[model samples]
Target: MRVLLVDDEHELVCALAERLGFRGVRADYAVSAEQALELARTTAYDIAVLDVKMPGMGGLELHQRLRELQPDLPAVFLTGHGSELDFAAGAARGEAYLVKPVGIEVLLETFARIAGPWDGQGGRQP
Candidate 1:
């Protein structure tokens, strides 16, 4: 499966992306919402893992914009802060929320649960 990971924490995001790649998942990462938007426009990712509390256009807003770009795009929100409000916002949106320091295996499982088996194609045919 192809995934997009966006988080301001550069090391964490890169590490996660690398780990996913090592496991045979095509993963791309961005450090900002704007960069994520640009990648979203170009790539039809199977799923997106976004930082719930970003600096500017937080994950919730970014999620909406991504859906606008590609309707039905599945999103899993990641947050290290784990604020109650953040949890509520993500839950209210019908999106999956995962606390940070999450394991790679758990992430893969989440992706499978939401987006189904990879199909080995990486993305939906446009």
Candidate 2:
């Protein structure tokens, strides 16, 4: 499945995207909310993995905008802070939330749980 990964930490997002590619998932990344929005407008991403605390627009707001663009798109939030408040807020919004430094396996598993199984055949399984 295709993924949109957004984070202010450019290096971290790039590394994660690379790792995801190695695992047979295609990922497009953006370092800012605006960039993510632009990518979302042009790309049909199946899921979005967003960093919670970005510089201009936080993940929550970005998710709102993305949902406007693609109402059924699934999103997962990642935060280095691991704040209970943030976790609760994300949960309240019915989003999949993960702490930063998350294992790729864990992230992929979460994606499968939320977005359905990735069949390893270039698309999600029904």
Candidate 3:
């Protein structure tokens, strides 16, 4: 499915997006929350992969705003810190989370679990 990835680290996010692409998952990434929001407005993303701690707006706030745009959109949080509070918040919100350096398989599997029938088709559901 089409995915939106947001993180403050440019290289990391770009590499992850490319890696995901190699796995046949179309992933667009943003380095900031505003950019993510703009992309969200134009793209009908099936899932969002967001960093928990960003410079301006954190992933949690971004998630809420994205939900406003696409209510059914599923999200997965990625954090390098792996703080207890972050984990708790994610759990409380029912959002699946993964620590940084996550394998592409792990991310995709999480996506499959959250959004069933992930065929790597990038939302070819029409």
Candidate 4:
């Protein structure tokens, strides 16, 4: 499925995008919340993968803004920190939260579980 990956760590986001491409998943990335928002406005992504702690807007806030842009879009939060507090906060939002250094397989599985199977056309199938 088409994914919008947003993180302040440019290298990490780009690497993740490249890896996703290798798995046959189309992914676009943004290094900032503003950039993510702009891309969200312009492109139709099946889901978004956002860093919980970002420079300007955090993932939760970014998710809210993105939902405003595409109400049906799903989100997954990624963070380096794995604290109970952070986990609870993310869980409270009712979206998948994955720790950093996640395996590619786990990421792909999570995407499938959340957004369903990719339709091979940059979208998800029902």
Evaluated with TM-score, which candidate comes out highest? 2
Ranked by lDDT from best down, the candidates are 4, 2, 3, 1
- TM-score sort, best first: 2, 4, 3, 1
Indicate which candidate wins on lDDT. Answer: 4
Count of backbone collisions in candidate 3: 0
Candidate 4: where is the Cα deviation over 4 Å? 119-126
TM-score of each: 0.89, 0.93, 0.91, 0.93
Per residue, candidate 4 scores C-alpha lDDT tens digits across 1-126 of 889999999999999999898777899999999999999989999889989999879998999999999998888999999999999988777369999898999999999898788765555675
Regions of candidate 2 where Cα sits further than 4 Å from its true position: none
Backbone clash count, each prediction separately? 0, 0, 0, 0
Query: Candidate 2 on 1-126: residue-level lDDT in tens?
Result: 999999999999999998898877889999999999999998898889998899989998999999999898888989888788989987766458888789989998998888778767557766
Please say which candidate is ahead in TM-score: 3 or 4: 4
Model 1: how far is 87 from its true place, Å? 1.2
Kindly list the per-residue Cα lDDT of model 1 for residues 78-121, writing each as its tens digit.
Answer: 88877888789887873589987898888888887887766434
lDDT digits (tens) for residues 43-91 of candidate 3: 8898999998999899988999999999988889888887898899876
Candidate 2 vs candidate 4, lDDT winner: 4
Q: Which pairs clash in model 4?
A: none
Judge candidate 4 at residue 122 and give its lDDT.
58
